[model samples]
Target: MDPAVLREDMVDGLESATKDVLQDEAVAVAMRDVPRHEFFDDERLAYADREHEVLGTRVLSPRTVARVLQALALEDDDSVLIVGAGVGYTAAVVAELVGATNVHAVDISRPIVIEARQNLERAGYDGVLVDCRDGAQGFPEYAPFDRILLEAAAVEPPRAVLEQLSADGRLVFPRGSQRQRLEAISATGDRTRFEAVSFAPLLVDGEQSGTLERNRMAREDREHAVRRAESRRGWEQDWIEWEHSVSSR
Candidate 1:
């Protein structure tokens, strides 16, 4: 079967399953147009079931990708930034959805970046700008982005990324621990506010250990304090009940 046909089938399935979640016509078309198998390693192609992480890079599930693209609400005039773009599949899809000239995709891995560029070129997505850079920092050279999509998860929203977004621009990423919800962050004068939805966690490197440690300690402390407070409250309630019973007798 042609990869294009497979892609269209996937899109159709996704649209059917998530009609409310993804209503954008352009996003559906983009999903149909991009051949996802081209982005994966030859070995991984056999398992073309759904999107999964490969080589530390995630090929986002069609449903998830379609949902996020709908959330972005891309416009033909919009300039988009994709962080942690693995092999440019999502970038290619975004470029097709939002015009290739307006898309820029960046990743921290040099090899992956090179592969992405080649894949885009081969797929006739010449308009996309693929580069290697710190996914955490974002691509500032193309500042004032109308939309920013982080392919990976971050401990906290990066200041650099927030700075790159144009006013009213929307950024979608995973936030929170344990329950890492997909958050849509919009830039408002000097600050960014977000709303939580479900999304897959992104992988990133650097200072992760310290951040994890801090979060663990904070969680432990909160649990300890809650336990102690509950213990005290229970003891107080018991004493009150005993005093009332004795006085009544």
Candidate 2:
């Protein structure tokens, strides 16, 4: 069967299961347009409505992707920061909605980030920046994002991510150490909880060490990461304020 047909069927299942998730026309369109199969080697599992493990990471189910996109409520010109990019399927979908140049995806796993970049480029979404870095920091160079998405579950939505949101922006992630519940937060700090969801726990800096047979990052990419790290040091003051704000909540 054509992957497009498979994608449509996937969306159909999503819509039938939870109409609220596909209520956003743009989200539905992007979900249908992005080639989900391109990100998966297992064609059968790609079309299934369940999470599939890929390269030590989990490609979130179509249902979860749809809900995250719907919660984001992205606009065409919006800039987005996506954490836990996995193999970039969710980033690809978001790129279709907000345009490729407006999206940035980051992951702590170096091999996974490399795979995500390759997958996205092969899928013709090379414009979306995929970075290998600590997702907890939330990409400060791209601060004030219109939307932020976290595919991994955390004890709480990182305040750093909330700080990245522009005024009136939306952030979505599953929260809880165990028994996570998907939640959406407004830029103003109001949070709304939704259905229970499961995801790998968000790992930070040293906690993300892993060996997956991929070689070290290319020299140029390594240099870029170093540069970003240097700049990140300057964001510490802003991080302090964000931390204080969340502490009050």
Candidate 3:
């Protein structure tokens, strides 16, 4: 079967009555144009709409990608920053909508970043820049992105990422911890919530795969411990906000 034919079938399924996930005509068209099979060794399964695991990070399903892009509402030439560029599949799809040079991606896992860069190049999108960075911090070198996409869930969307949005820019992310919703926030601070979804929590420094510390809670525990240590009489003040004054420390 030709890859083009497979992509057409994939788009058809996404637009079908049962799925109806790819409602945006531009999103559907861009997705159809991207060579998703190039990102996979087994091209046969590339068109499957289910999530796949790679480098200890979950590759978002096609429906999830559709939802994110729809929420982003990307325009031609819109600069996109992908916070969790796992296999670079979403970035490649975005490159179809926005030029390859306009797509910037970052991942907390170094290996994933390297792999994502390679994957994007293999998918014929070599101009998309993929970097190793904390997803919370975002890719600030190219700050003021027209559109930003966070592929992981967070209880509170990182303020740094929000700050990186261009004036009138939009951010799409899975918000919440145990329960998550597809949320889009504009640079002007208006929020739009979409359907409920589940995604793994975002990773931070020293917590990525193959790192010494598997403790993702270390940052919070450290913050609370510091608060206790700094207390006048150990427990003088309650730890209502675990991240109070964390930046100064």
Candidate 4:
């Protein structure tokens, strides 16, 4: 089936599954415009009402994305900050609701950030800015955003990121580690809680623990190789000296 058709069908399923998710025409339109298939390799699952892992992060189901976007109540002129942008699908949807220029997406994974930038561009959202950074800190340069969406689970809202919101901004995120609740916070600190959902922990600045351990091991291997080379050179020197002495005798 054509991707556009599949996308429309997916939105339809989302609207049907969730009570009033696609009531907003903007969100409905955006969901239709952004081709979900461009974000993932599996075209079959692209429009399915299921989640897939992309770049080590979850590409949330259309139902969840619709629910979050609907809860956000985005405006065309609103500036959006999307944390944990996985392959840029959600960002593209937001860009469609708002103008592409009004969206700034940040992800801690550099490779994922690069992939998202490429995906957005490929999907014709060239104006969206996808950056590799600590999403927990938010994009300070683009502070005062009209809305902020966290695609990962956090134990609590990061004050730094929350501070970046505009006076009337709204922020949505899944809270807790083992068990999570989707919490929506208003600029004035009013909060609304939704149903439980599981999401990966939010990543922060600094080398990832796994990457750090791998780097340490690589450094140790290099050091061991250098020591072995030096030892071999010492042995070679000894052999040369003995040969010279023997020849002289």
Cα lDDT of all candidates, in order?
0.67, 0.79, 0.82, 0.78
Per-residue alpha-carbon lDDT of candidate 1 for residues 1-249, written as tens digits (9 for 90 to 100): 767666666666666755444568888777777767777656236125456655545677666677667767788879999987677788888888778989998876666778888888888897899887666677888898999988755556677888899988988776665556566777873333334444334433221211222222233534543454456655454332111121122
List runs of model 3 lying over 4 Å from the truth: 210-249
lDDT of 2: 0.79
Better of 1 and 4 by lDDT: 4
Segments in model 1 whose C-alpha atoms lie over 4 Å from true places? 17-21, 42-49, 189-249
Write candidate 4's Cα lDDT for 150-173 as tens digits.
988887778888999999999999
| Model 3 steric clash total | 0
Question: How well does each candidate superpose onto the true structure, as a TM-score?
Answer: 0.72, 0.80, 0.85, 0.80
lDDT preference between candidates 3 and 4, better one: 3
Residue 70 miss distance in model 3 (angstroms): 0.5
Q: Candidate 1 or 2, higher TM-score?
A: 2
Candidate 2 matches the true fold with a TM-score of 0.80
Span of 10 residues, lowest total lDDT, candidate 2: 240-249
Error of 4 at 198 (Å): 1.8
Q: Over the stretch 1-249, how does candidate 2's per-residue lDDT look in tens digits?
A: 888888898888777755545667778888888888888887678989888877768788888888777777788789999999899999999999889999999998878899999999988899999998878788999888999998888777777778899998989888886688889899888998888888877765433433211112234434543454456656453432121121132
Query: Given candidate 2, what's the lDDT at residue 234?
Result: 62
